[model samples]
Target: METPALEVQLQTLPSSPGVYQYYDKNQKILYVGKAKNLKKRVTSYFTKRHDSHRIGVMVKKIKEIKHIVVESETDALLLENNLIKKHQPRFNVMLKDDKTYPWICIKNERFPRVFPTRKLVKDGSEYYGPFTSFKTVNTLLDLIKGLYKLRTCNYDLSEEKIRNGKYKVCLEYHLGNCKGPCEAKQPEAEYNSNIEAIRQIVKGNFKESLQQFREQMKQHAEKMEFEDAQRIKNKIDVLENYQAKSTVVNPKITNVDVFSIVSDEGYGYVNFLQLSHGAIIRSHTIEMKKKLDETDEELLELAITEIRQRFSSKSKEIYVPFKVDAGEDVKVTIPKLGDKKKIVELSQRNAKYYRQERFKQMKIVDPDRHVKRIMAQMKEDLRLQVAPTHIECFDNSNIQGTNPVAACVVFKNGKPSKKDYRKFNIKTVEGPDDFASMEEVVFRRYKRLLNEGEDLPQLVIVDGGKGQLSSGVKALEALGLRGKIAIIGIAKRLEEIFYPGDSIPLYLDKKSETLKIIQQLRNEAHRFGITFHRNKRSKSALNTELEEISGIGEKTVIELLKQFRSVKRIKEASEKELAEVIGVSKAAIIYKYYKSKKET
Candidate 1:
């Protein structure tokens, strides 16, 4: 169902290696593709049937066709990749790995300066990396600074300017940090040699620098200059130590880029490992969004070009999981065995791990996914058949056998359902019997739910150790719900979770989401119960004090409290103020009682 406009445009397409773009009715790019024969490739969409449903649907939506003729297939490939990244067409594989990473820049100047930068200036300067961390860049820079006496100032160290003595030596020169290159105190030949050594080190090559240092140390030792020899030996040790730490493969696998991709239905995670002199100095994972149902080969090919350009990778050979079209000039190897295969497998493992961590982070950041994950985790942790979408936690609050109360806090989907919370006065349990109080409250809660025909909670949590948990289990048994509901107890000290009929407790990891949710529930229940208990205790104490006043009846006490709110406020009130609240005679009695009590 190609439109008339698209058919005319397709007919005019040149028989050349180029990039083709498909557009919808509104002139929005639907897909970007590269082909050796642009005419044949663009026509195949209309002439042949696509097996992929996504491709079939995308073809039907095309309203116009656009193309850019290139000189070669390599040019088409690079152009297609750039277009995909820029426009992010609906039916193109788009690499979402555009995060700006730090790079070590070697500035192009009379006296070159080297520093870490996040931007690429395109000023004929060489950029080394898009390093995974600033710490790595800083460590390498520190190592270079220690081994080289380079200038730290930003002066225009031109030959004429240095000859004219336009700049003076700074504190860095006095501290032995710099060789005063700006004042021409250090020879350009010597400074250039240090720069060359730095370049070798940055490229993960230590042999040249180590050899020079070793030779210097030997000559110094032969001349009986032990201190200089020791200093050179220390420098060599530092270089070797750093090289050893960075090396992860055989020394023969030099100047090669390793790439491995792990893809899902929507996105692909591609891991890149840069090896120089058999050392993996750079490792990064790039995530790409799938526009069409692109195969791993297609996604990876696009990613290889994008990554190489972004990181300024100039490796002539690349070790990939599969053969990729990265131009005829670049050698692509699909390793079958040995260290190369091992490194490829390692890169694949890193991609897989990166994908898993990314999915986990997405779940945590997304509210719906977060709830679903937590609920599923809770179900598994508690050994429940179904996810605990609805959960209730009980805590008993009592102070020395008085004002006994229990609170139940509800959670729906790992979040507190505060409106569904319930509080119970300890009617059946007397004194400070926490176990009995827990039993009574659990029984009352589920019994009411059973009578009201309300849905039962998927899980029940008791905020205590085994004794309280056993008591709660007994209540469930009495209600014929011993096995119907999942119940567990959490201890205060270690946060151990105890199941009924099992003495052993389940200790979740400290950082586990399930443990955090359970802790939230337990803390909420305790807080709710304590708040209710405090209110009851305060009311009881207030009533008791009022009753201590002679001839002050319960009705009068109620009126005074209703008006004054508290005994302290009542005590602070004047006789006329109290009379306005209660009757004049009762107000006089209350005022005198508080005055005499204060005097005593």
Candidate 2:
């Protein structure tokens, strides 16, 4: 509902490109948008019905409209972006994790000092980044230090001062770390040339420095100055090595900005890659919280404008995953195939990884909400009538029909409830029968829960395909609990998930939360069952081996086995060692029996 004042104000808007801002009754900015025709764009908000609920709400809240007429659509775009960033309008896609990254600064002085800084001073000095990480800035600085002999002093290296002998060479000069520009020991021409090369290297253009070094090396080699040539070669190797690690694509793809976006329900992650000479010189991901169910194109367009301004990018061409309006001055390319497309994909991957990492951090910060979301997602994915707040998965493990065992792993609210985990010896199943083992375990688990009036799992997972699932279903039917609980089977190969009566399996996306939780349950059950089976097999083998010895009673056997851990270890023990462990009488019998058996 536009106010009478706003209606009159909107009627006066120019039919030209500009930015428009919407203000609520309190005069605070509610939204900022750009338009090719300010009058038409502003009037359309009142005339047309918005499909998005957020936009509808924003429209109703608008009380006043303000317009800034610009020279062109590009100007309007820039102004809109600036206003959004400045005011952070309520209806704008706002960057949530907006923090200024560090940059390497070359101070404006006679001999410029280089270091990392977060501030952008507008003197004659040069600043390199807004680098994604301080570690990256430090690494570049360290590499520069290793390659060049630059003065660290703050002294004014004027000709008059040097002629007057106002400064002396310092320890940095003696240590070969500095060329002593303060004392005129290093010529300004030589030092400035190094600075120029540093500038090129920082800009991701290594060809200049490499060419200079290569020419020097060639000149020295031609004059038979092998040591000087080797030094130059070493410098060239260092520069090339650093460049190789920094560059991601073809060196020919220079001076371009690449942008890619990934979005979910609530947020969009836009990743930016700045390329110079085919290397990724700068890469960053900006997270934007959606305010109006903004499309990826809208979010991406906003991000490109903001990022380009922040990083001072002047590339005439930009690469993006889709077509976008970045003003007519800047060519927007949607590369279909080849190296450009690969870089676009790489940017998208980075954005996705960042989004995943943010989700992990959110889970750590709000575990309860994370669990609830996971449960909801699982319910939707599995098509369950209710959220599977409590899930149980059963796995059977057997070794050649020896000491068969089954394990039931419990998950509560999408997390493992280790205290509720149970292991069962194969009481009803025999001879390595997985189906029967699964049936018996599932029945026993739920039947006991029913008898005790305890809660049954909302979902049951059997660690096998259709056969195992059928067996579980049969057990549920025996207890008259069929269709009361959701039962499914997971097969290891292809991760095919089978429902109780459905022949065709549901193949979950490999990256889905539903698949991850199911996989966790299956793996845990298998691990628990295998551990129990191994212990049972070891105990059975120990008991049989020791009991076969004629003089060893069960009590003595228990004591000896407890001490020595195995029958072979007990047999291998010395008479004195055995006596110290189990007493001389038992020790003597054990030692003599082993010795006679060995001789035989």
Best by lDDT: 2
lDDT of 2: 0.89
Off-target runs (Cα >4 Å) in candidate 2 are 1-15, 37-53, 369-600
Tell me the tens digit of each residue's lDDT in model 2 across 305-347: 9999888899999999888989979999999999988999999
Clashing pairs in 1: none
Model 1, 402-490: lDDT tens digits are 89999999999878889999999999876999999999999999999999999999899999999999999999999999889999999
Instruction: Give the per-residue Cα lDDT of candidate 2 at 581.
Output: 74
How many pairs collide in each candidate, listed in order? Answer: 0, 2
- Measured against the true structure, the TM-scores of the candidates, in listed sequence, are 0.60, 0.66
- Relative to the unseen true structure, what is the Cα RMSD of model 1? 12.9
Worst 10 residues of 2 by lDDT: 542-551
Which residue ranges in model 1 land beyond 4 Å of their true spot?
4-16, 47-53, 122-124, 367-600
Clashing pairs in 2: 250-278, 251-277
